[model samples]
Target: MKKSLITSLAAVLLLSATAATAQQKSMGGMQDMPMGKPATGQSVHMARGKVTKVDAGANLVTLAHEPVKSLNWPAMTMGFQVKDKMLLDKLTVGRMVDFEFAQAGKGYAITGVK
Candidate 1:
């Protein structure tokens, strides 16, 4: 009876370990990588830009930004969606800012601005 109990316990442990590994694999190996997106666990990219325009009603801000090395984006003028409209409260035309953002959907969305 003792041997049978020990054997059954060992089998249960092995099965549990195997199932955990399989579940992780099914979920994309312990990390999710969204399509056309940067690698997981990487820091969000930061860049410096000057605000060129603000449209609070539309929840957009246009910026003339410097190059973002991590994202390989060049200096240019572009409009970005504000994730939180309050982040746009202090932004105005011609104000210099240090900001962070991530690519979302088909455009860039500002994660922060200062």
Candidate 2:
């Protein structure tokens, strides 16, 4: 009986560990991979934030954005590359924007803004 009980307990522990690993993967394992790189099929995320800075010459915009639920990110300020330099024309420091972005090579890229 003791042997059977030990086997059952071990099985349960193994299953629990497997579940935890799966949960971490589903959560994006962001710490293991570069930030903004989502798992397959999670291509886009929407966020709203104030434009903190715009580097038109580099096509980058820095924003103090609200939490990004899709990416499981808390509110934070970060820079994103714009898909087009022209997108910079619509962004101004201190202005609030609603934007859509996707994971680019090693960073995030803004696909649209409103």
Candidate 3:
């Protein structure tokens, strides 16, 4: 009876360990993929913010933006990409403007500005 009890306990412990390892592998798989990138032709999210910095050379504009409700993003400062260099000309440091952006990859790309 003691031997049977020991074997049963060991089996339970092995199952628990297997479950834990499977959970860890699933979690790691999630991290390996990018989750937030928007689909192609997704609707742009409009947001208003000040142009904190503009890097015309890099075709990037940095903005301190208000909460983006459509994307569930909170107010924060981050750089965005512009497909056309001329778009950066419309932005200036400390100037407020409304812009539309969609996730292009791991980052956002400006689709329109006003």
Report lDDT per candidate. 0.66, 0.71, 0.67
What's the TM-score of every candidate structure?
0.61, 0.64, 0.63
Give stretches of model 2 more than 4 Å off. 1-42
- Candidate 3: minimum summed lDDT over ten consecutive residues — where? 29-38
lDDT rank order: 2, 3, 1
Model 2: how far residue 67 lies from native, Å: 0.1
Reference-based lDDT, residue 72, model 1: 49
Candidate 3, lDDT over the whole model: 0.67
Query: Which regions of candidate 1 are displaced past 4 Å?
Result: 1-43
User: Regarding TM-score, does 2 or 3 come out ahead?
Assistant: 2
CA shift at 96, candidate 1, in angstroms?
0.3
The TM-score of candidate 3 is 0.63
Which run of 10 residues does model 1 get worst, by summed lDDT? 29-38
RMSD of 1: 20.4
